[model samples]
Target: MAIFVHYLSILLISAVIFLLLRAYRLRRLRLPPGNLGLPFVGETLQLISAYKTENPEPFIDERAKRHGSVFTTHVFGEPTVFSADPETNRFILQNEGKLFECSYPGSISNLLGKHSLLLMKGNLHKRMHSLTMSFANSSIIKDQLLVDIDRLIRLNLDSWTDRILLMEAAKKVKRNNKSLVGLGPSRLSSESKMALLITFELAVKQLMSFDPGEWSESLRKQYVLVIEGFFTVPLPLFSATYRRAIKARREVAEALSKIVKERREEYEKGERKNDMLGALLGGEWEEDQLSNEQIVDFMVALLVAGYETTSTIMTLAVKFLTQTPLALAQLKVSCWKMSGTDFKGKNHRTVVKLLDDVIDTSLPW
Candidate 1:
């Protein structure tokens, strides 16, 4: 008992000394004003709890009220500054890699790989950003992407029937009960799943010209595992989710690497294609030819970004539209108009305009 108590005292003293040293070091820096919260865990728990609630702004609002729009807090095992001021955010974005560098959590950086565009710095980031933007330019969207989007959406909508639950359909729920007494397997419904499939298919088409198939579906399943760990604690030993994510990330990388190698072989054989993978291998950007590993990492990051966030935005748009009758009515009218008209030149522009309005109004943040 005496020995145990002595060791406990030593541990406590060490922790105190570490915190004191941290505080002293922090004091030297001109950090924004805010509480750092508890030691080790910091304000992460509070941040997570706040996000779980519908009105998450209170967490920031209370802090902003006390300490202004820009404040400091520790999250994901790092000291971070929260900037709510639009001007500060604009400045930060405008001066990326000059005044500030990309500083994602260790887990995110590990999962995304060093070559991922989200972690790229300086000249490399500029080049990749320009390349990505080139693919997403208005010409590409109107001429190529919009056709796929229209077809896929219409195909998905065609499958919808009366009495179908939108959220359940989106989520791809497998079971439904017709009566209190009877329970049986029903047609799957999930807006989120539908959105994921649509976006994933579109992205795969654009990136690799890969059609939706068993292989793509399997890859998508692995990606879901990777996304689940994005915001979790980074300790693999303590976090089963993180461990699974790490494993899944490796599998995803391997799969992408194989595809990239195959594509490179195809390119070398004088078989040219017009997708993003082809663009990478076609020596279009001869100044800096990305390695196979870099290409794979880039694809993985793009797939995650395209698949996850787009689906989330779609799901949220549905949720928000359901809540707001006026917006929902306007959206329905727009959809009706889109469906009734031929999707050509002027009509396509009108459809795009309606889509922009829907996106603008439906986004929660």
Candidate 2:
């Protein structure tokens, strides 16, 4: 029994020595300090859990505390190096082509398409960025898209009143035999909340000039599905979120392709429209025009960029406004000062007119 115990102790010590030796050899090149967690999954679950929290700083904070500003970890099933140092991050971004090429997670690249502007690198990326930026510049917004956005916002707000059953939008003012209608809801309710979401969707639709009859709602649905799984694991298992996302991505590509075909017919007939898609198809870029697939990818990228972010901001802004009285009061005061209206109006045209007035009167600088 004593001899058996002695051999067991020797085996344990040998295993420990072997592991230490392996670790040292692995770090012989002086890699950043951090744990890789486990094989295959690595620290993906931990990263997801940390980001799921309201305050995600602690995940990095704890690591930075132990391993310094620059460290390594396995996240999203990739061996990743995280730099908390701003200068280092800037250096990496500025020297992207030289030091490291731009890349995305497998899930995102798969869902957004390998040809997406976000995933592209080198001279091709620069050309794509330039083309897209030309369509989204301040001059274009002021001249064309802003007018469309304002119109859509008014229409969406008007439609909202009809959809909501739980909120009263206007009050009756009676003077003797005459009845006068006062504008606006007294407070935010469940109905207004629903209206806000629809307004955002409508705004995105009109801004992008997606065909209102068929493609708008279907495309929106597919885009939403793709977005919901953009950060999920890129597993191809049956009924997986990633699988659904890939399917939705293909559907979106099909829809965009159809639209591109229709637009081509419209261009042939000399019917030029005032939307991003129309501009892209009609614009004169003699040598470097985008192919149909590239245009579709760009449109998808643009839609994903604008839709999710704008909706999220509106949702969070409404939430915080309702929860924070002081902030709400400041917003009301600022809006009134900027526009000279209290935003209490039942007529969509009236609200739009007020906005136009504000824009007309504002200083250019």
Best model number under TM-score: 1
lDDT of every model, 2 decimals: 0.75, 0.62
Could you give candidate 1's per-residue lDDT for residues 1-365 as a string of tens digits? 99999999999999999889878777788798888876766787787666555457899999999999999887766778999999999999998768877678877889999899888877888888888777766464456677777777777766676756675552332132111111111221355557777888889888988877888888988877887677666778877878999999999999988999988888878997778888777645656678999998888889887775686676666666666779879888877766756556787788788878778766554
192-289 in candidate 2: lDDT tens per residue? 43433454355445445652445576766677678756655555663376678888999989988888888778877998766677767767543556
lDDT of 1: 0.75
The count of residue-pair clashes in candidate 2 stands at 0
lDDT of 2: 0.62
Q: Model 1: how far is 215 from its true place, Å? A: 1.7
State the lDDT at 287 in candidate 1: 62
In model 1, how large is the Cα lDDT of residue 174? 18
Taking all chains together, each candidate's TM-score versus the true structure is 0.80, 0.67
